[model samples]
Target: MSDTEAHPVRISSHPAQLQALEPVLKKVRTRVGDIPALLALAEDIGHAAPKPGEGSTAKLWELLASVTAVDVAAGRALEPHLDAVAILAQAGVEESKPGAWGVFAAEGPGLKLEAKRQADGNVVLNGSKPWCSLASRLDGAVITAYTEDNGRAAFAVNLNDPGVSCETPLWTSRGLREIPSGTVHFDQVPATPVGGAAWYFERPGFAWGGMGVAACWLGGTVAVARDFRTALAKAAENGREPDQIALAHLGEVDRIIASVTAYLAQTAEWIDAGSSADSSNAWSEALRVRATVAAAVERVQTVVTQNLGPAPLAFNEAYGKRMADLSLYVRQHHGMRDDAQLGALALKGDRRW
Candidate 1:
């Protein structure tokens, strides 16, 4: 079959299972037209907007299990949740800066809460997670922090508290200038711990967390590729070949995207097997995926800027926004720079997952 005939990637149609996710997948394509919107969405949601079928390690796994058949049928069965602890950690800290939970790292630990113990001895949270997509928008989060054991524990934070505050302003990226990637602050926030230290590192969810982040990165890269193709097609219609450099850049993007997709698929299959839950497998795979995705996003920026030139930068609002958004989004993952070290460790099988 021809390239067009063989590579027909379409959203899954299991409405009851995916919970209206077809539109979300389409929205991701539309919203991530370039880097700016990508960054804005990253800043707004902390990660790519959680698609209907995706999960947050613990709460969403049951949902994932229920929909695994749909995922399998749709060719999305291997995309598992990353580690629960790590996802919670990254969600609360790494994904974006300038949003509500963005300030957690800067604040350090040992903060107090506002609400009393719950009926089940759980505490209600009362702080605003400034840029949280679902929680900040709704009013709370499943939060985590360092315990007396010097390990992280998880909890839920409520945004509706009188002390919870959010500044819903957009970041000043020329491309994705409309997303509400603002700051949220909390005072005397109340929270209850869900899982203890084991949840942070030794749990089963870490491998899944590693996979999930990679999946988001892969989606963003594809969006940029789509934008580039649209531009190239337009250029061809105007009696012009795409600049030679642009074509070369597209080639690079294709290479990285293909390699990462294959690797993620392999990792997902391993996880689904249930016996390959080694820490080394999880960490190394996660690191490699993030590194590849980050590189793909960077390549898109370089190619887009060089091919489209200053005209798009100045005249094309959509393109410019995506460019800017991507520039910022690629940097959100913590320890991404050490991806090489993680890869080395994975190759040696010497590190924990």
Candidate 2:
């Protein structure tokens, strides 16, 4: 591939879906660190779905995966914003005004970030929230907070609000470091209620959006697989016949990729058909797909690293970054606990096949 053509990631099954994304990727490449350009690219790509049952939602997930394979850190930063916006829209929180959005709703005691109701019936958010991505950059956010009357509720806060203060970017990990995920301190920040209490998590789109993250993992894993492929290719090009051991390893990797892909396609069909709107099916499938995809991704990474050795790590900066970013991003999966919960639910629900 030519230098200009080489960077494009048509590495996945959805080549048609990636056509619209190529320009977006190219724009991001030249104008690196330009947030506005990235947002514009998103807008041009159009909303994931203009209406609840509309648009190419599956393709959107594929696009996210492809981008992540190219640059997992950037892909990680972008998916949360897009996914949150989609969920908020489903819950009837329309952004009449224009700006970027996010969700800060990692719930629990000691998680702080409480919402208060004043006598005037206005909501003011106060406290610290964790895992807030693009904390300093997002224009608005869909926040979950504890309120006296409603207990836990979802609220939409404008980041530009005077009362909102985000901590300095403090993520020190080499992986996903481009993502400025940190603490967001809400100090009496006024916000508009997004949906009735619990609506954010209740919306079916929430699970669908979660699947999209797995797609990004798939993309990142493909990127790692390519590293191994390239190592083999370089050997062949240098007049060395490929060893049977490496050839067999490649074949095994291919089989796993094909298996994961078939599962992704099946899940995408379910989501597009709106089966995900069914809570039982959505939750079960979400857990299943996440565990499956996460496992395949990690396996690809492990196999490639074990065989390729440290040359990619020591010599190739982009390859090293992708490896690190994917390593962190795939951790979003919950492993055996996820599978256990899914199996229990499947048994209780009598989900056949």
Candidate 3:
């Protein structure tokens, strides 16, 4: 059978899901300038967003993509909070309060957050953590800190704690300008351990959450591609046929978008089926999806910008922002480093093929 016959195109749930959020997304498009407003939005999404591995993993990713298609920064602000909730759920911990959350796992050379066991059988965090986005605005966070044995563990802490202080970095990035990621300091801040040592990275949910970020990247790409399509439609309506170059770019954009959509759908199915429960398989799948989506975002950005020229970027506020946000957002993939890790895994005979 041919590829088309083997796999028929099915209607996507994204349109219906996005339709339901049109009202909220309309507000997001205009009022996405402040942290407080974004925090509120993230909290609302947290209440409604689906968790991964719940047999509706595709819906969860589609929701993420839908939000990102509206505003990339809003999606960035929302993803970590949702990921934190998912982590809590996976760890069987009840959310202690009703507020926005963040996940701070990025570590730096000198900065380190240490988790110490108190005599009262509780954990306290000390030192500083890097790359904590919206740390000052968020109510809580799921942070990774070094345990006594020099192993990293996940801890849930209240950001409002007196011992916790956020040091705002000199963020000068044009993309995602509204969301400034900075360092957070903890001085004897009380925390609740979510899971045992290494559980944070070991859990299949970690990979699932990473893939959710890729969905956001895909959404941003979709938004940019839409602009390219709109430009072509406008030209055609004005009695100007798009040249072969423009058509070629559009074809490439379509292929990239279709490939990413199919990859995400198939991976979501695997996750919901429990096939990605294994740590190695989950890691491999997440790495591949993230890498693929990241590359697609880059190519789409290039072709869209090349096709549309500098006019839209200079005058179109929304288009420019989407381009910039996607450029920065997809950099979380770590380029060749992640690819090297995947290669190492394969070298160790962790092949799915």
Give candidate 1's whole-model lDDT: 0.47
lDDT of 2 by residue, 212-269 (tens): 8887888787777777887788788999867887888888888887788778777776
Each model's lDDT: 0.47, 0.73, 0.85
Residue 285 lDDT (model 2)? 76
Which number leads on lDDT? 3
Model 3, position 258, has a per-residue lDDT of 89
**Model 3 vs. true fold: TM:** 0.94
Residue 330 in candidate 3, Cα distance off native in Å: 0.8
TM-score of each: 0.63, 0.90, 0.94
RMSD of each: 9.2, 2.7, 4.9
Show where candidate 1 strays beyond 4 Å: 1-136, 167-170, 174-188, 334-336, 340-348, 351-353
Candidate 3 per-residue lDDT, tens place, 118-206, comes to 99998899999999998988999999999999999999999999999999789899898888889999999999999888999999999
**TM-score of model 1 vs. true structure:** 0.63
Best of the two (1, 3) by lDDT: 3
